[model samples]
Target: MKRQLVLVALTICAVLPVAQAQKVGETVATPFQGFAHSAKGSQLRDQVNDLVALVRAKRLSDAERKAIELQEKFEASFDRKMRQYSFQSKEEYLEFKQSAPEQFEWIDWGYKETLQMKAFIAADKREFPTALSILATIEKIAPASAGTAAERGYILNQLGQPENALAAYKKALSLSTRYQSQRPFQAAALRGIGFALIELSKLDEAEAVFNDSLKIEPANKVALNELAYIRDLRAKR
Candidate 1:
């Protein structure tokens, strides 16, 4: 039992999902790839990188302040842009959206990606409540965001709220249906679900969820480890 618990702890550490800013060595791969092509978006990306640098330098308060400022600026810019256009009907709005998808991508980047950084900063500081509040705001603004839902699940799991985490992960899976190509997000959500189930002492269910996660991400070390742990657990039973 002690060994099983240790495995669970290791699994949690391995799968703690944190939304990170684009690091220097990493490539920017997101659904909003086009947003990076725009001048304003590129500027915002730079600001986010600066925030990341502050965090890396152990300037948590400064990073948090910068994150808040960035969020506010993004909100103001988004509102100003929206006020510049007026649509006569829903059809017209849909037409505009189809024609100018980048506009929506920018909005999504502001609400999802930017806010995610804020939440990550708070979480890194061990300010879990503040992190959760930021995530809640993201959910309110972008209800269909699978990433946000999965993030919430990870946070809630850390808070020892497995039931809520399970719900959040399941919601992420449901929201991810529209983003069929985003298998990594789906696998992450499934892994969160499995972790939550393990916390609930539902070993069999957790094993099943981990298997499903592995099906999505064949190279998922976390799921593979958890599956081995679960099998060991059952063997001792």
Candidate 2:
């Protein structure tokens, strides 16, 4: 029962924006906006934007179906284009500097955001494997991204892998400190860690982790409610 409660809290914390049905078939705005300066970037961004709109505005099954097809085609298009430039290896992508510098720069900036949006769609659909795959690709592209690590941890937790979730959260925290501007993200990572500890029945450790998270943001309702729930459970014991 306690574990179920913890799961509920985690789910609420991870709740993503779901577009209303009335908004279906509409192109939605995202953080990855204005990425259409170049012809190639514009085309790819338009397609991805459409996919994102479908994912958020329609039902989950329909959204997932479309997202899967779009992802396949999107990857294939990139693969075909890179092959034309002899960029066979992912590592050899930097060679684009010689062939298509503009494309190189555009992809370097856009792919990360594109992959992140795809990962968000997968997570929204509760497709853990797809979400993790997208996140792993992002990790390779941007290794120092604490946000990616924290999101990976959230997916792992949703899949009931608390041990792995805890490890991912720890990595996020370590990386967060190195990127000072990510302190707020670090607090979220801390809250995730606390939830993982709770799942593992490490109550004392969980309490400390939640308290530390609350210290980072006093009005953190997630941490505050968790603290109260922990106390209630302990008192009942």
- lDDT score for residue 86 of model 2: 18
TM, every model: 0.67, 0.61
Worst 10 residues of 1 by lDDT: 5-14
Which tens-of-lDDT digit does each residue in 1-237 have in candidate 1? Answer: 232211221122123222342221123345334433442334465576566566556676886798788877666655454322222123323455676635543342333555766777677667889878988887765554566778778878888899999998889788666443222467778888998898898998998888987787788777877787778778888
Query: How many Å off is the CA of 196 in candidate 1?
Result: 1.0
Stretches of candidate 2 above 4 Å error? 1-107
Taking every candidate in turn, the Cα RMSD to the unseen true structure, in Å, is 7.2, 8.1
Candidate topping TM-score: 1
Query: Where does the lowest 10-residue lDDT sum fall in candidate 2?
Result: 17-26
lDDT against the true structure, per candidate, is 0.61, 0.59
lDDT (tens digit, per residue) of candidate 2 on 179-206: 4423436687888899899889899999
Q: How close is candidate 2 to the true structure, as a TM-score?
A: 0.61
lDDT of 1 at 76: 65
Model 1, residue 170: C-alpha shift (Å): 0.5
Q: Relative to the unseen true structure, what is the C-alpha lDDT of residue 91 in candidate 2, on a scale of 0 to 100?
A: 26
